[model samples]
Target: MEQQTQDKSTMVVFSGDLDKAMASFIIATGAAAMGKQVTMFFTFWGLNILRKEEYVNVKKTFMDKMFAKMMPQGPEKLGISKMNYGGLGAKMMKYTMKKKNIVTLKELIEMAQDLDVKMVACTMSMDVMGITKEELIDGLDYAGVASYLADADESKINLFI
Candidate 1:
């Protein structure tokens, strides 16, 4: 872990779509299992994936409240990028994945956490969206682009999803 070298994998998650978030977690867990140092930086809409599934009692401005109300709480509420059809597509996709025994996004997130894959939430994005750290899940690092860049610079692989 001390060595910042080629065995590192980094991804900037800028999409909140269920498919994109799942893909990011899948890659992160897979890379971690392969013994790579993985870091997933979530920004903008992607931050929604880290939000608490239950409503958090955090004080916010009117605009912030609006954003919170509109944004998805967690992986379960995320919509697919295409064919969402008012979230029906996401529901269908989750059902099919479960039927096929494919690991769901929530499971992938747990795997990533268990594997020690770093999950970073962009503080700047959170501020803009009126999201508080308390509103997100636990065991996450709050940072800015500089921190993400540092990880990316040391990583052999970097992706923006």
Candidate 2:
């Protein structure tokens, strides 16, 4: 019998918004659970979602420290894309999700990791933003646009968020 290849799903996460990040993770995890090969390429502000909440105390340049202090620390600190109301909107959204019994974004990300979904952090974006590997969550690959394009080219499903 001939073996069938699994479908591939590639997602380019470019948004830092809490809601959008949650959506991306939800889709990635769902596809992975369905036995599809999934890759999530995080770029630009999307990288913020993978940042560590606690300070890592890594030696960085003055500018890098400034950038780190200015940006959201992690997924829990991300604001909504619209009507953020100084972060109130994000809190409200989390509360609503909890009330509705929806899986939290953190949980979705954890599930994706557990399912062996590939997580790639865009090197170009990191360089431009002065974000170091130590600031991001562990167990993720670092690559550039060409790498993401390679995966996207083979993917039947692709999304940019």
Candidate 3:
């Protein structure tokens, strides 16, 4: 009998909401823990989750600075998808998770990184959003749609968040 290889999971994280970002990272880490190859493709608003809260002091155009100023810097600054009363909802959710002994979104993200999950930033979206590599967390691969598609083609499971 021919041997089958380990499964692969590909996730496209398209939302910047704290809940969705948590879900995506949780799933990616879970799959990685299961010995599956996992890849997370971050595009558009999803890039916000990977952003650094502190400014990187990189030179940019006026539009880039404007975009940086308008968007939330990191996961901690992200608002919830629903019932976000000026960010209060997200704070409440975090408190609830802590009370329940559930992993925080930030911790989950760290776990995903430690588990060696492939994190890919969408270059096209970065260009449009004026996000530079200096603004994102370290150790991420940057690629275009074609690269993501190729990974998806080989993946046994695919999800869009």
TM-score of 2: 0.94
- Report lDDT (Cα) of residue 13, candidate 3: 97
Error of 2 at 123 (Å): 0.8
lDDT over C-alpha atoms for residue 85 of model 2 = 100
Q: In model 2, where do residues sit more than 4 Å from their true spots?
A: 1-6
Q: Note each model's CA RMSD in angstroms.
A: 1.7, 2.0, 1.8
lDDT of 3 by residue, 2-69 (tens): 11224788999999999999989888999999998899999999999999988799888999889988
TM-score of candidate 3 to 2 decimals: 0.94
The digit string of per-residue lDDT tens for model 1 on 1-161 reads 43667699999999999999998998899899999989999999999999989988988999999999998899999999999999999999999999999999998998999999999999999989999989999999989999999999889889999
Kindly indicate the candidate among 1 and 3 with the higher TM-score. Answer: 1
Find the candidate with the highest lDDT and give its number. 1
Steric overlap count per candidate: 0, 0, 0
Global lDDT of each candidate: 0.93, 0.91, 0.91
Clashing pairs in 1: none
lDDT of 3: 0.91
What lDDT score is found at residue 29 in candidate 1? 92
